[model samples]
Target: MIKRSILAAGLATALFVAPAFADDRPPTPEERAQIEAVLAAEGFTSWDEIEWDDDGHWEVDDAVGPDGRQYDLKLDASFAIIARDPD
Candidate 1:
């Protein structure tokens, strides 16, 4: 009984957390370009560092902007510009 209860609790926790970890939003063209630019400036030179966040948003790690500053830009799924400097 205790094992079953623990399993059920774990399942319940997973169910609640799964969606929170899911990325359902899509990126827009401008947002894509911005992300790419950041990646390029950061010496990524590839698509390896670009990825979607759990909220269906996009993100690029160690990205450098045109201003020569490094940051992590977060974009909404719609590709709309969202948050910047997440960390």
Candidate 2:
């Protein structure tokens, strides 16, 4: 139905727009500390993209490892690595 299509489009647009706003705010100092811990542990130099998600987890994207591997990492509030997947 037209109503459903319109609603879907609006939802898609909101999802896309939301990240733009989220990116405007860099990681908090506490968050940066947590993220840094992960980088140090994994021997990564820096984070290409780091953001705090609604789930209270820091999602780190494109972390270049010591061996030159790109990694996407997730950390919980305590900064523990909950997930690490290759980019």
Q: How do the predictions measure up, each by TM-score?
A: 0.44, 0.62
Candidate 2: where are CA atoms >4 Å away? Answer: 1-25
**lDDT of every predicted structure (CA atoms):** 0.62, 0.81
User: Root-mean-square deviation of each candidate, in angstroms?
Assistant: 6.5, 6.6
Error of 2 at 82 (Å): 1.1
Question: How big is the positional error of residue 7 in model 1, measured in Å on the Cα after superposition?
Answer: 15
lDDT of 1 by residue, 1-87 (tens): 999999999999999998875654444677668766555655644332567766456876655555655666665655444665833
Q: lDDT, candidate 1, residue 20?
A: 70
Query: In candidate 2, which residue pairs clash?
Result: none
Instruction: Say which candidate scores most in TM-score.
Output: 2
How far residue 63's Cα lies from its native spot in candidate 1, in Å, is 1.4
- lDDT computed for candidate 2: 0.81
